[model samples]
Target: MNKYILNKQQKLTTEKIRNLADSIGIDALGFADASEFTGYTIRNSRRRDPKLSLPEAETIIVAGFYIGGLTLPAWSNFLYGRTSRLYLSGFFLDVVKPLESIAAFLREKGYHAVVCDSSDSERSVLPLKRAAVRAGLGWQGKNSLLLSKKYGSFMALGGIITDAVLEHNTEEEPDRCGSCSRCQEACPLHALEQPHVLKRDTCLSNFLQIEYFPENAQSVSENRVGDCEICQDVCPWNRKHLENPLKTHMTALFQQKIHYWEDIFYLPNLIKMTEEEYESIFKDLNTGIPYSIFHRNVFLAMERAKKS
Candidate 1:
């Protein structure tokens, strides 16, 4: 059975919103109640309550954008520093535009709506993965990433908090990761020693985002310039997506400029790039990577390449 919580007059139906979302290129979407997350797992109040982000919030709309196709086979070559599919697709930040379009649609229908920037964890309105699970979009895998049956972990999540009451799924997707610890075993840093829980401090993805790379990071970082997907790569759920990826509307955009990226991401070319050159190439992408850190990673990747 589905649940529809009424807050104000229903200005829009789920059908209208779904149609708008489909037109806007959102791959997977679901709706959830805006009530505070009451559970032993999510302890942060800000992450729990959508009302904290938007006091008038009555519903949460979660959206996922597939990025599995962005993963390049050439990325594994140490001579060419690799970036996460999330970064390559610019979905880490560009995803806001699509979600904002949905928010705009709700506001046009006389409902208040605000988009949660998926890239900003500190100010994110709600727990996107948790909300996605509640909305029946997917379940949180042992890697702690929201895993869709179709897209796997190669999805970037975004959300909308609105006053509009919408029909939502009452049943959450049951945990499908029974006895699967591939993610835990694959994490080089042992960040996922505990199932469904990531130790952020030890995570290479988190480490690369920071200002200083640890001396020990070079050995494990391999050809990676920014972010890590070792856990996602080894998951059984992601095997099909990894093997035969699907394209989204953004695929055309990627194909158009991927040649430039292919040239620049080569470790030899990347190490010679000035901050201005880097800015010109990546500024519009909004990858959230500073040139200094990225350059350092490239130099390290070059050294690794030489060793190999």
Candidate 2:
């Protein structure tokens, strides 16, 4: 094919992919030059190199799905940690699955495609938040989260890397968090050091999600079992959208009522279960968070309750 014809075909294919993503409920979709993120570092020594995940990657297609901001209210319910799990589960179904489908579609078209989820821990996978920003989907908020003007910071991100040289969207979202420090002040553990900078070690959410709680975090690791949303909750962007009523249409699988931390920790079967058994019960909550970590958090919450 002539160079001009090839370029036109590629643009058409890219548009088709974007249209398909929108049809599948992806709130935002954009293509970024994979090479632009070749040396993007997320933090200390964590560089985002697309080539690591997909050697043939030429373009990165980033997508975002709105995870309704209203879910925060339910997260405030200390007795049941259902909101975060529900949001994550929905993210897999809504964001990850669609990205996988997009990759499959690209592969069917004879392009080398690889899907990357936000939960992926592999070093090769570029940070989806940065990729999204590069694609003009949103900007990184003060809380270190991708904040979209349309969806705020409540959106979940997923992406696909393909060798196809699609029409790219390089428009970057300018930082809109000018002089706002709500997230920094809201962190109970003082995790936010400054705008766009975070102390992961001191973050309660990080401690609760890991298998073993750090000795230094034992004091504040109580009452929360999994993800923490305090920083996002206090963000002006999130608060603006949360003013609307919550959309309770989403399903929560493990919604069994529990009045207190003891209700979860003292259950006869729960107390006697082996690590493997305990893991099986909460395995679906967040694949990134191991059952042992959650179990440990429960114990901490129980101890805190007892002391109080």
Candidate 3:
């Protein structure tokens, strides 16, 4: 194929990939070539004790799906109170199915796309997510979330890295969060000191996701033990454009006033939460992600309730 014709096909292939992701339930999609971060990766690698960035990756495709919203039944009136691990709050399992499907599709099309794993894979997830932002899926929010001008931070990220020599797309998204302090103000533990950066010591999500909390963060478990949504919950951009099932599921967190401990703590019951009942709780439009994390969170919540 001639260079010009190949470039045209590459663009079409990019669009095809993006469309496939959407058709499979990805709420947001983006394309980025790994070459964009090579220099930074090298420089950072030299300075760190160990590095996670992959030097040879050529393209990183990022897709995000929604988790769900918070309704009157989901939150605790107490600043540090019990909040359940219902469907809306946990959908990590659902997003993975579509992600794997997309990756398989790309591989069948003759690309070696890799999904980075912070736990299982040698490559870093940050670079993958960073590559996603570079492809214009969203801007890096102060809270370290890739917040799309089109969708707030209420999305889960899935990534694919490939060596396909494709022509890069130049379209970039404008950071529409102009002077917005909602995310900064919403953090219960003060994680976001500035826009697009996070202080892990104070990040609630970090606190729950990590098994061992720092000595100073003994309060972390007593307080925000599960997932933290305060920052993303308050974004104006997230308040809009929630018509998409995934986006609506995520944006629903802020549309309520409620006082209740999480209703379900036992994991075994999830197998029975009816489709409507499950969707009403977690906001997951599809059953791709599982409720494992939420169940884990429930165990913690139940522990907290016991202590109280």
Candidate 4:
């Protein structure tokens, strides 16, 4: 039988959980009814060991927050640059402890609640933007990111899926990206085949993370590094959010990771370090920039810089 029953305590528990999440550094906790998520297209397309995650999450609380601003330091342009992407950086890292704490507390409370691993392999959880939509947080913008009329897509998503059935206070918004194609038009590689229809293989960010680089990219520029935020950057909604706290979400790595590119005019530095060294220096921050990717992008940058 389902372990949880909805009651006044559930309402109080939701508020307490939200309060605790904020105390942990989350900016907002919006609930989405995901009774229909986690099947069909998503389940069949990806493969992840379900044992690595919890099961049967009936109610999902989506978290959206970010860190942007001057505190947003540019990724280092010079090799051995003393800035690090190999670790968490920026504002988002501030909330990790609090997020974890809330999860632990809920476990103690006998609720079958758990955080959806943002990087889960099956990625079985509903997309975070969809979660926001179910919660009435905002409308999905053209970029396929949930754009709060007040906020934007420059946000990170975290969620707690629970067995507690709660009312959905959602007001779905129409796509507000009418006649405006900034996100698509501004894409560096024409990655957006059509609005909300990105050609995944061509997407720079996806390419950086999941696939091998093109032979042609071996000679391309380095300004676009491990992850590309170009599409998100050009959205009219995102543009207006330049000053919003969420725009510059930094994690622990932002405050303390080393960027190395002292002499990129020459491409030989790519060969200067052994793979073992690469693994050692970058092992900790492998969450985003795994060594192979980090090295390949940097090496590619060095190659392109000289050609330019």
Candidate 5:
């Protein structure tokens, strides 16, 4: 094929992929040349090795999904009840399912495509926030979350690494969160060290998901465990968008109604369950929140409530 014909075909293929992604509720999609991320190092964990994860990657297709306001309550709920499980499971399906479909589409077109879930901490190959920024999807906010002008920081991300020589977005998202310290001041654990920098070790959100709670995070209430969103809640960007009536109604539906420790904990039921039973119930709901860790968080919350 002539150079002009080949370029036209590539442009059409890229457009087709974007259209497919949009149809499945992907809020935004962008592509970045994989070469731009060569030798990239992830700061949070030393174990991540991107090159080893996706060998000879030529393009990275970044996908974003705006978290609806109604789902916010479930994410913040301490008890991890039915509503919370639904929201967490929905997130995995929403993000991963679409990437799987996209990867299949790419594979059908004779390209080697590898789908990467944003929640994969074990083999967390690439820094997704950086990939999103490179694709011109958004800028890294002061809170260390990717902030899109349209969706703010309330979004989930996923990506696909492929050998296809796809078109790339040249534009970069500039830092628009100038001098915003609301997220910093809101963190009860004081996790934000500086703009776009985070003390991951001291982060309450990080501590909550791990196997053991940190001693430094003792002051953080157990009710605030499991994906704490205090920083995101206080962000002006998030607040502005959360004012929608639909979201308000949704949040109200999932709002915590149980006041007593016994009612919230269901201590009798939890205590009766065997370790195997507990794992069977919560294993797949949240990627990192295992049964034992969740039980510990519930126990702590109950203890705190009793003390008060």
Candidate 6:
């Protein structure tokens, strides 16, 4: 086949992938060249180069799932230990399924494909936020989260590394977070002192994942038992989402059982919950919190509740 014919065929295949992603309910999609990321330091060379993840990688398919509806104001009662929208919506694990479907489609087309791990950034082969920006999905916000005009920081990102020569997004999303400092100021631990950067050591969201949080984390983690989204909550781009959040297929299902979740996550009830009950309630979701650590967080929240 001639080079022109081969290029046209690749473009057609890329279109098919986009349609499939939409049909599968990916809220946002973008394609980027699988090249070494040089705009920032990733420390890990393997993560900075897509070729390391998939030797023949020529394109990266980035997908975003909106979970704004899950972050709505109703779930913030101090009497209950709360989890982030990202957590309650099961996005950590839910994102893998759609990306895998896309990967499978590429593999069937005689292309090598790899789906990045969705549970943690460290586990992911690509620096997903940077890749998302290059893919034109969004720009990095002051809080170090991907921020889109529509979705803000309410997106759960996932992607597939593929050897297919897909049509790449020519333009990167320009930084729209100009002059916005709300996310930095909103951080209880001042983790975002540097714009578009985060100090993971002082980040409350990071602390919650570990067994022991510091003394300062106690006061700020008043009602939170899992992840924290205060920085995201204060982003000006997220104001619309906060006012009228968008509902995804996954979050819509979670909404139906909000009351049930509220009952179970009530700080007092969580403090008294047995191991079996904990497993039953959280088994399907990919929340990383163990029963013991979860109970400890609940105790901390209950202590703050008493003070309040």
Candidate 1 local distance difference test against the native: 0.82
lDDT for model 2 comes to 0.66
Query: What stretches of model 2 exceed 4 Å from their correct place?
Result: 1-6, 42-47, 69-74, 82-87, 90-95, 211-216, 245-281, 306-308
Q: Residue pairs in steric clash, candidate 6? A: none
**Candidate number with the higher lDDT (4 or 5):** 5
Q: What tens digits encode model 6's per-residue C-alpha lDDT throughout 1-308?
A: 11232477887898899899889989999988888898657555577888888888888889998888875343567887878878876766546766787888888988898888666555578788998998999998889999999898999898888888888887887888888798898898999999988898899888888876999887788788888889987888999888877767866876788777777777777898998888888977767677888888888888888888
Estimate, for each residue in 5-86, the C-alpha lDDT of model 5 and write its tens digit. 2377778889889999887767789988675454445555522334455677777889887664434333344443322222
Question: How many residue pairs clash per model?
Answer: 0, 0, 20, 29, 0, 0
Models ranked on TM-score? 6, 1, 2, 5, 4, 3
* Overall local distance difference test of candidate 6: 0.82
Distance from true position, residue 134, model 4, in Å? 1.1
Error of 1 at 114 (Å): 1.4
lDDT string, candidate 1, 13-131, tens digits: 67778888899888898988888887626576477788888898878899988888786667867788888888887776656777777788788888898788777565577788888
Give the higher-TM-score candidate: 2 or 4: 2
lDDT of 3 by residue, 1-308 (tens): 11233477677777777778767767777765564455343344421111234455566676776544443332442223333222234443333556777678767887776665322223445453466667777777666677775556656676666766554545666666778788888776677876777787687666555555454544554434355566765777667533343335344443442222243323234334554664466554332333554445445555555566
Residue 201 C-alpha lDDT in model 5: 82
How does each model score on TM-score? 0.93, 0.79, 0.65, 0.74, 0.79, 0.93
lDDT of 2 by residue, 197-254 (tens): 7788788766676665677667754455566777876788876556762333231222
Worst lDDT window (10 residues) for model 4? 78-87
Please give the TM-score that candidate 3 achieves against the real structure. Answer: 0.65
